[model samples]
Target chain A: MIGRLNHVGIATPSIEGAIAVYRDLLGATVIREPFDLPAQGVRVCFIDTPNSQIELIEPLGEASPVHAFLKKFPQGGQHHVCFEVPDIHAAAADMAAKGATVLGQPRIGAHGTPVIFVHPKSMGGVLVELMETPKGDHH
Target chain B: MIGRLNHVGIATPSIEGAIAVYRDLLGATVIREPFDLPAQGVRVCFIDTPNSQIELIEPLGEASPVHAFLKKFPQGGQHHVCFEVPDIHAAAADMAAKGATVLGQPRIGAHGTPVIFVHPKSMGGVLVELMETPKGDHH
Candidate 1:
């Protein structure tokens, strides 16, 4: 059901510092400017790769999950791996039926596409994000 | 210069248990049989997706890096994200020149491709793996 590896989310204490690694070191030329998503409680930016993207996420508030991750690791780390699914609703349903814990209802993700998170416990302790590929961008 | 996301490595205590989740829960039909990579000090298997894969890694011995990860988290978690680079040597040199710690030297990775790892400290604490794509598989 997974289409492509959409983006790998990295929880960072400082997005600017992480951006430097991708920009100055990796020579990534198409990094989108970072933006805050209050609803998601994080600030995010996309570092485009040849086939996918690296998502840098920083906590926007104390209540943010990224905040807790930062508190635990201080330096931050890989937070989640997102994969594109052709249909979010069906993916979630399939996961639920097969005993995977779907976090919540499908909601608009950072890419403006419906997405749902699978509980880490059910996915070998790696948080898995299932996103419906935006129309016309399907692979 | 990343080519594509080859795989997201997930450290797991039990490969069998993780395989069930990918097979029964996600309905992945192209799961590769688990194999032990004694050189890498881990047992691994590829769960193929449309565009990439989920590499399930389990510690093979006390010296395994996955052993350390499991000790810290117990439940296991995302180990590292591997991105394909057209030239692993150049990628390592480029990262080193930019002050990123390229761990050790490029060695044969699970996919039989030359791969190098970047230290997490220089990458916002997210361990990044850069691998040269196998010939004839360029994207």
Candidate 2:
């Protein structure tokens, strides 16, 4: 079962600028600095909201999925809503069973958690992400 | 000071359908049903997340600002992030003092709370909202 919302991902052209705006303008504290995830072709920084988090994502390469999202929707806005789950693989399977398109097999996300993306078509055009906490075996 | 993320507002084409999707598909419970806010030009339903809430907004009139936002950005998606504050007026004043554009004077919001919206331009194109629990006098 999907749990609480972990974070809202914001796709930006420049992570540095987005960070400054979130921190200075919105008074949000930076929970993590920019970190690269080569497999995902992006770098991420996390800003803490009182109850959740705001993930800032910047494409590391032209081939990145985030890069394509930006190219298609250049509004510099919300990218996805990630929900915490106990088992990403199970959640993805369940969603697929319910006629939702699973983006891919569960993989390690930037925070070392297993995660998968659900296509927006199943969610009324809002991209939904499911993430699982790292298990002892995976870590 | 902002305490935590209060909720994320999603502008949807259909409030009932959206509520059903969140409840049936995501296993979320409806904390509140559709409530009309004529002053805000919208009707909203609240679904509880583990830590926060997802507010589905359905605009009541074509002249509503949310309608304009939908017209400009046709994709039904996350609309704004609201932070819980101790004092809405003070927070709005502070934001305005920091060169951010305050959308309006703090007004009574849903659940009898005082709320104000910060302009998207001030927050890197992401709309930010500040909300305060109403004091006894205001309530």
Q: Largest lDDT belongs to which candidate?
A: 1
Give one digit per residue, the lDDT tens place, for model 2 in B1-139: 6667777888887887787667666667545868999999999988777777788888889977789877865656789888787888778878988998998798887657889998777776678888895455321
Among these predictions, the greatest DockQ belongs to: 1
Local accuracy of candidate 1 as per-residue lDDT tens digits, A1-139 = 6767888999998899889877887667888989998988999999887677889999998999899989998988999989888899999999998888899899999999999999998888889999999999845
Model 2: which residue pairs collide?
A50-B4
Q: Would you list the C-alpha lDDT of every candidate in the order shown? A: 0.88, 0.79
Error of 1 at B115 (Å): 1.3
Model 1 CA deviation exceeding 4 Å by range: none
* lDDT over C-alpha atoms for residue B102 of model 1: 92
Query: Could you give the DockQ of candidate 1?
Result: 0.71
